[model samples]
Target: MINVGLNHFLIVSGILFSLGLYAVVTRKNAVMVLMGIELILNAANINFIAFSKFGNLGLTGQVTALFVIVLAAAEAAIALAIVLNIYKTFNNVNVDEIDHLKD
Candidate 1:
């Protein structure tokens, strides 16, 4: 059996990115889009940690990944608030029909 290594992490990240892309492309709901963004961020974090642990990239990669996770949480909170506001304002969360405020 092939020993798991950085390649495994890369493969997982690639799969995650693909899934996120599909979600973003096929989803019509704003919340689903947010979920896809979260998945993408998580995949990046996975790669960061993997490189930090297995490669010569040193500790900075892990530190950066930690910051990314924190920022992702903050971003998720703010984005959710905005989505909630949009839902309250429009009574729907569809992404393609909210272009009326551009006057």
Candidate 2:
């Protein structure tokens, strides 16, 4: 039997955050960047849940994680809409390629 502790959760969260950051920094597609942002948010939620469980906090972590989820959903919706519009206008969804909104 293995005991999963806060350190274990922290390590997982750190990896997720790092991967998210790398995706955001290295990907040229807007959608990939959004996915990376979601990954970062998920990593934060993991930390929140882990701390809430290990630190004896009552419902705070869960509540915060829920709020983060909601926020991430809304952000994704709006960002995708913007990306679609940009694609419609510029015929490209690449973040680096669509730098100018006006031609």
Candidate 3:
């Protein structure tokens, strides 16, 4: 424990964002892709909160971060529901295999 600081938070956020991007690009599973997107969003959220708490941005950043967290939850729910519907229709959760949309 090296007494986490602003730089530490930034580094963690960078790593999280990179890993999330890699997972999204390398994974073929729709659910995993969605999870990676969520991870990226969360990494950004962490950065916001860190700057809000440790930096001198005051409460504005905190309020914005709160809103972002709420939106992230809502987006996750809606996206997961859509992914479930896709899985039900295709019997698979692979993003590249979802092209049989009939009218």
Best by TM-score: 2
Estimate every model's Cα lDDT from 0 to 1: 0.89, 0.95, 0.87
Task: Write candidate 2's Cα lDDT for 1-103 as tens digits.
Answer: 1687899999999999999999999999999999999999999999999999999998999999999999999999999999898888988888888767676
* Sequence-dependent TM-score of model 1: 0.90
In candidate 1, what are the lDDT values of residues 1-103, reduced to their tens digit?
A: 3998889889999999999988888898999998999999989999889988888878988899989999999999999998898888888888888877532
> Best lDDT goes to which candidate?
2
Cα miss at 27, model 3 (Å)? 0.9
Tell me model 2's lDDT, rounded to 2 decimals.
Answer: 0.95
Cα TM-score per model: 0.90, 0.95, 0.86
Which lDDT tens digits does candidate 3 get at residues 1-103?
A: 5998888988999999999999899998988998898889889988998998898888877788889889989988998999888877778878776787742
The true-versus-predicted C-alpha distance at residue 64 of model 1, in Å, is: 0.7
Q: Identify the superior model by TM-score, candidate 1 or candidate 3.
A: 1
User: Total clashing residue pairs per candidate?
Assistant: 0, 0, 0
Task: Check candidate 3 and list the clashing pairs.
Answer: none
